[model samples]
Target: MLLRTLSCLCLLSGVCLAAQAQEEKKAAIKEVTVFLKGAELRSESKVKLPEGESEIVFTNVAGNINEKSLNVGADNGAVVQSATFRNNYLKDNGPTPRAKQIEDSIIYLSDKRNLLQNEITAIDEQINVIRNNRKVSTEEKGISTEELKKLLSLVRTDMKNLLDEKTKTNDSIMKLNTRINLLANQLREENNRDDDPAGQITVKFYCKKATTSNIVIKYVVPTAGWIPSYDLRVPHINAPVQLAYKAHVYQNSGVDWNKVKLTLSAGNPSEGAQAPKLNPWHLGFYRHTPVSYSQPVYNQQTSDYTNTAQAGAIIGNVLDNNGEPIINSVVQAIQGGIVKNGTVSDFDGNYILKPLSPGRYDLKTSYVGYKENITTGVIVNSDKHTAVNIRLQPTDHRLEEVVVRDYKVPLIDKYSTGTGRTITSDEIDAMPTRNTRSVASTAPGVYDGLNIGGARGDGTMYIVDGIQVYGARGINPSQGSNAYDNTMGNYVATENRGVNTTFDIELPYTIPGDGKQINVAVKSAELLASYRYYAVPKMDKDAFLQAQITGWEELDLLPAQTNIFYEGTYVGQGYIDVRNVKDTMNLSLGRDKKIVVTRDRDFTMRSVKTIGSNMKESFVYKINVRNTRSEDIELVLTDQIPVSYYKSINVDDVEYQEAEYNKDSGELLWTLNVEPYKTSTRTFGFTVKYPKRSNINL
Candidate 1:
């Protein structure tokens, strides 16, 4: 009986032990606690248990425990199953029933509940203490009932204030939670909006990646405006991708967000049709409307510039191949297009153009007789003057014939006048001439011998380039006569002398390799006037004859016949020997005359001691001449004055005179015979006297 009883006791004890073991197994749960720092203030509360190993999400934990700053660990004796940080959240102790939920709930409400309870308790204690002090009022510190009531009322007011604050705080938390839930819902709704299910989309704005990944987006704000946005929609997932997008801002439309276009493709940068998109995506805002660029207007008044500014400029001269001035050349400023201005050269073949805006320009010159020339890409600047000297080829215009019109006579022929003629280069080449002066002689009435208004002559004034040659002769003989002769008696007449007073000394040779045109102006009447002034002789024959016929018998025997012999007879028989004769003579001798004797005498003639007693009268001759030609030419003037009639023949004020004949051309050219019709005048001075007959040895 005893053995049976013991077996039963052992069996019962084993069953009890097994039952305790099973209860212990049921009590062992995976306990996890997540501590959230810097979280919303709230008290701990029960949370619903999650099935299986569930993850807990915490958002916007305040304080310093941010997503990057968060750290997770197990309690000292507790096991840490798992922990993770994701989506800017700190999650710890996962895969635990009620652990994550309970901690999250505590984190949510701990501060709020603690603050509310602490305020309540503090207010209650203050009210109680004031009541106790009123109950034990002393002489020194007695608390009045009314004062006590007021203090209690203040406590109640404090409680109300605290409650109100708590309510407001709770309201804010609820609103924030609602907002977060709305955002989460919206995300969920748009999750499938992407066309490429396998592709993960990302939007980088101003270098920062978007908060959400694998999303379709629009209306992204740029640095300036809002624009449509896009992302890669492809088969590849979680791949680093780049997309280029264009945004436009219209002048009239403000900003067009819908106009954005994005491109996506990949290849070698050099071989690609377009450049690959780069990181830190650049958002370019292009103009929808055409952008009109305006140049700045510089105001001289204020010394300020507007939106646009004026460019600097250059100024300089343009020349030809011969270093001569190029006239009427087109100078242009070229940037994208051309702006042109024309300038012509002055008399010296010099030109100046100024104040050109700074830019690249082409200098093109065109003249009638020269080939057109063009110089490309002439950089002009304000700092320096651009000097462009262009050498132009000879044009066909030089070969063309130049027609010479007949010379028109001036209205007043008697007055001194100047003649102008235009002779082109072609005409100069065609005309025959010994020198350039001969070319001028082709004109009618031009004298070749004197080179006065004649072919190959030098009577005309010669001006070459801008310099006047020395010894330039005008048509008037007095104006151009040699400086030696001052008296009118020695003046030479230039009338009937074809004088080419105008010639170009600049280009003496007309056919000197396509020479330029020459302009000439001749003054014939002026030459004549000059000749009459300085070339004609002034003599007093009457006084000379009176001095010579001193004897009265010789005078009586001289005449009784005619008035011409009266003076001679008066001085011949009874009168003392004549001393001098004087008279004014205006003689019009023929073209070819040697000795010009005057018939009229005002007084008697006489013989001076210098001559013999038989000599009675004395006379002097004077002459002058001029040269007119393009070039210097030989000139000669010959006069025969009887030595018997003149005591002395003085060749005074003679320029370039020859003693004998000229070997060249077998012509007496003591006066220059120029290339053309040139005028030349010569003057000679002579003193004639008669010896007395008594002293004469026959």
Candidate 2:
């Protein structure tokens, strides 16, 4: 009995030791919640666990993950002991299918190109041999004249054939070279990095008994993000506008998301959740000091609107030392130690850093296997697009570690449409902001758009110190901001979380690891809109058809570029800035040639007089709207009289017919209905009285 008891104890000890052994398993990404700046990925695996503590290693995960935001869970009453994340440099996350295809084509073309060059070289060598033997050797035995002539003729024929072959081979090589360059361009567009390693998650779990447990893993990655855009289509003037909401998703997060459930969140999890604190305000006398700045060495052209605080943009290309385009290279605009906006270079290596206030900024460009290039003192002038191309040098060694960086995109992309309101010096002076960036932010074109890094409220909720806090939450449906509607939730489900909105795509999507924009439909709605023709002849002589939509808040719209289509025709592009929308959402359709508008100064009513120390100038302007279309149109004509801020100048005797005039702004508006092939005219006159010592242009 003692011998049997000792044998049983030894067997039990052996079983326990086997159960505590470490096991490696691969996790499949099941879902992904992509934020404006980051993405949360959820993966799952099933593994058999033994009764004691077992170390489970999950392989083939996103290498660009934020380790602090990683979490692991298990079923079957398994208790997780510890979880850690590490870069798996050995794991092969092979090139994407498109990239592989391009690589194969390039290789095949390159081989052909080499073969053609070899053939050309042989042909040249044969030609040289024929030329060298042109002269007969005198030491050699004498030969017949007829034989010599035949030999010379044969050598000439052979040389001609060789030259012809060389020409053909050279042509083939040229064609192959062209094809190889095209394939290279395509590969760059794919933005595939073959050496991008996978990540691993090591989790230690304790189980009471041996059983198969379902394991779930979640983590946040900063390399993936999405941008919002819209398609606004109006069939005709009387039809309701069809709004198609879409998301432009992009990722470079090592792991390819194949048929994964996707959710797009407007809220950013990278932004700080801590509320900002205000410092104590103090009043002090103004100190005059001279400010100096170093000019950009590459570009020395000064802007004309710099003093007006107009928004500007920087457009450039990211290239390698060999002048090859570097796709998806991160470009950041840094101002005063803070990164203002960031963007990645396109497939063509072009990047646009937009909506920057007229000021000096530093540009930093980074890529995976290249040395970072920092260009300081890049001047962004008002109402201009500055070109600043950057060249990144390739690294000599492989990168063993991945460094994660935050990238922020501009709120307003003025360069896209080549249209934006310029803030004047007076407007900047009236603004409460003290800095140039703040003044630009307050400008009319700025939008509340997507960000790649930084934290925002309402992203994820957490419990801190037994108190509920708004923090990182992922994978759990209770915390997920998935959008849904009773009837319209088939393709996309939307949820309004007050601070931000989320669109959960119902269908499975296969977004590759390539850093390219994948368009996803979010929501579609046909909203009723009223149409009217508007024109400000003083500024522009063209009449624009505008669509006004009421109750636009229910659309859950974000600030994005909107493609306008009217009357079954594609119109110009416009911007939908939900942050600036109020009682009505007015969209401008393209100009209408059918409605002719003209503004002319009425010389008969214009007069100038000097009374004592004061000079009075009277100006009258007439605006005519001619509706040449078959249908009658309603036109709103607007003209403004100069508003004086000084007490010495006063605008008086403002006269108009059937028009509304604002007293403070001195703006005149006339709403008129004109029949087809008929014309309607309105005239407004105002008198400006000022001291004779001052000169004013009217």
Report lDDT per candidate. Answer: 0.28, 0.67
What lDDT, from 0 to 1, does candidate 2 have? 0.67
Worst 10 residues of 2 by lDDT: 450-459
lDDT of 2 by residue, 368-410 (tens): 3466699999999876789999987754432111111112332
Per-residue alpha-carbon lDDT of candidate 1 for residues 1-698, written as tens digits (9 for 90 to 100): 99999999999999877634421101111111111101111111112222333222222121111222233332222222433322222222222222233334444455555565666566567657755754564333576779767866766676576667666656666654554444344333222111111111111112122121111111111011111111111111111111111111111001111212211111111122355776896789976995432556542211234342234443555555545444323343333332233334432335544435567877655443344577788787643467766565543321111121123332112232222222322222122221112221121211221111101111233332222221132234332111112232122121211321111112111110001112122111110100111111222111011111112221111100000001001000011111211121111101111112222222233223444344333332323333222334332233333323234322222222342433332222233343433433343222333334433221
Return the top candidate by TM-score: 2
TM-score of 2: 0.65
> lDDT at 452 for candidate 2?
11
Each prediction's TM-score versus the true structure: 0.19, 0.65
In candidate 2 the C-alpha lDDT for residue 453 amounts to 10
> How many residue pairs clash (N, CA or C atoms closer than 3 angstroms) in each of the candidate models, in the order given?
146, 10
Candidate 1 differs from the real structure by a C-alpha RMSD in angstroms, to one decimal, of 49.8
For candidate 2, what is the total of clashing residue pairs? Answer: 10
